[model samples]
Target: MRMNPTFIVMMKCSEEAGVQNPVFQRLYICLGALKKGWKEGCRRILGLDGCFIKGFHTGQLLTAIGVDPNNQMYLVAYALVESECKDTWC
Candidate 1:
């Protein structure tokens, strides 16, 4: 088993829709502790899943998970994307 690597990289992007409207384009959040834990204590396989969101602003909840030695799911990263497009995946 490997431990998750530590990191501290976060990104947020947006664009102005109108004179007073700002639309969220993309967001990425990853923690160093989570990464280190994953690398040190988690298995090699990584699971990815998401679902369509329903509300005022529609989007998807994307997540990355890994299995640990005890076969437990470990959360690695998460994001809220407008859609499951190729660009978003990358």
Candidate 2:
């Protein structure tokens, strides 16, 4: 955030039984450069999608994409969430 004032990074945590500290629940990120580029040169249309991760750390990968002038897919933002549901989407 210090490097880029427009950069955004948010994290959510929850308390669990027998845990001294809060457990990480979700994470969202948006790069300043990508956001600026999308707003300046990319189309207004946006595509949102998600996929499940299959490794040890299972979670959902959500992404927001945009179309550039050349009709190429441009990544705008993304988030790592526990699951794909109404709560996470918001």
Candidate 3:
């Protein structure tokens, strides 16, 4: 048996104003390896939704979940935004 190397595919974050606020207005997650795997095993259709977060910062979680052949849900991509406005969706 053989094992592949471990590494970080994607990692990113955006801050609000100067370092003072340090709050992230938006956050995204998309793993390069997962994307490639999805293309090979997942369906073409993707389900998306947004929900409010009750934490201190208070925001919306936008996500795209992939529906596999077995009707299972797999995370494809996601984002945390300050709001769920039209501009943000676009």
Off by over 4 Å in 1: 1-12
Best candidate, lDDT:
2
Can you give the lDDT of residue 9 in candidate 2? 90
TM-scores of the candidates are: 0.78, 0.89, 0.70
Which residue pairs collide, candidate 2? none
Task: Provide the clashing-pair count of each candidate structure.
Answer: 18, 0, 0
Per-residue lDDT of model 3, residues 1-89, tens digit only: 12433322332345656665454467767665666667788998888989999966798888888877798997888887778877565
List the global CA lDDT of all models: 0.80, 0.93, 0.71
User: Any runs in candidate 2 off by more than 4 Å, and if so which?
Assistant: none
- Candidate 3 ranges beyond 4 A from true positions: 1-22
Between prediction 2 and prediction 3, the one with superior lDDT is 2
lDDT for predicted candidate 1 compared with the true structure: 0.80
How far residue 57's Cα lies from its native spot in candidate 3, in Å, is 1.6
Which rank order by TM-score, best down to worst? 2, 1, 3
Winner on TM-score between 1 and 3 is 1
Report how far off residue 69 is in candidate 3 (Å).
2.2
Residue-by-residue lDDT tens digits, candidate 1, 1-90: 145444544545666566566657667777778877899889989999998899898988888999989998999988888898998866
